[model samples]
Target: MNWLILVIAGLFEVGFTTCLKLSDNFTNFKWSAGFFICISLSFYLLNKAIQTIPLGTAYAVWTGIGAVGTVLMGIFFYKEPSDFLRLLFIFLLIGSIIGLKIVSE
Candidate 1:
């Protein structure tokens, strides 16, 4: 469904962002390619989802998922900081995303 596509798009957003970092300013060819491909696909799917979902809701959810996933990826793979306040805000972002979905329905 559209929601599934939106979720996949959001996941692709995370992937593209991570690949962007790994690309090292586009110096790494493989990661850079991945970054471009994932971003294209993410946007394509997001555009598809917006046909049904409200623009504001879809955009917020998309960015929320991307932000949360990217932060988790940074924490786990890149060994970035994982402090309490950081986690609290991540959860709050999640809550806001969920709230958007609920109110949208």
Candidate 2:
């Protein structure tokens, strides 16, 4: 259950980050509101997850998910570069996150 919450929190991290980009330095009211709401929810869920999961492990995984999601969003939505090396490194990051999950047990 906690792990599920952690994953949800990580997803919210992605949501908040995307809103941050769309917020245009907090000038845009809707996106800025979304940013604040998502961030608050993300942190609240993260706090709940940490009640069961180790701090370091949970934090690392959360950030890893956010980082990967953000990069993918950048590529797909912003049309950022999708070069081979960048993709390879993203996969490597995924592998590392999985490794962390395995070892954390």
- Give lDDT: candidate 1, residue 72: 99
Off by over 4 Å in 2: none
Candidate 1 C-alpha lDDT tens digits along 28-84: 999999999999999999999999999999999999999999999999999999999
Candidate 2 per-residue lDDT over residues 1-105, each given as its tens digit: 998999899999999999999999999999999999999999999999999899999999999999999999999999999999999999998998899888876
Clashes of 1: 0
Worst 10 residues of 1 by lDDT: 96-105
Model 2 TM-score, all chains together: 0.97
What TM-score would you give candidate 1 relative to the actual structure? 0.97
lDDT of 1 at 48: 100
Point to the candidate with the largest lDDT. Answer: 1
lDDT of 2 at 30: 100
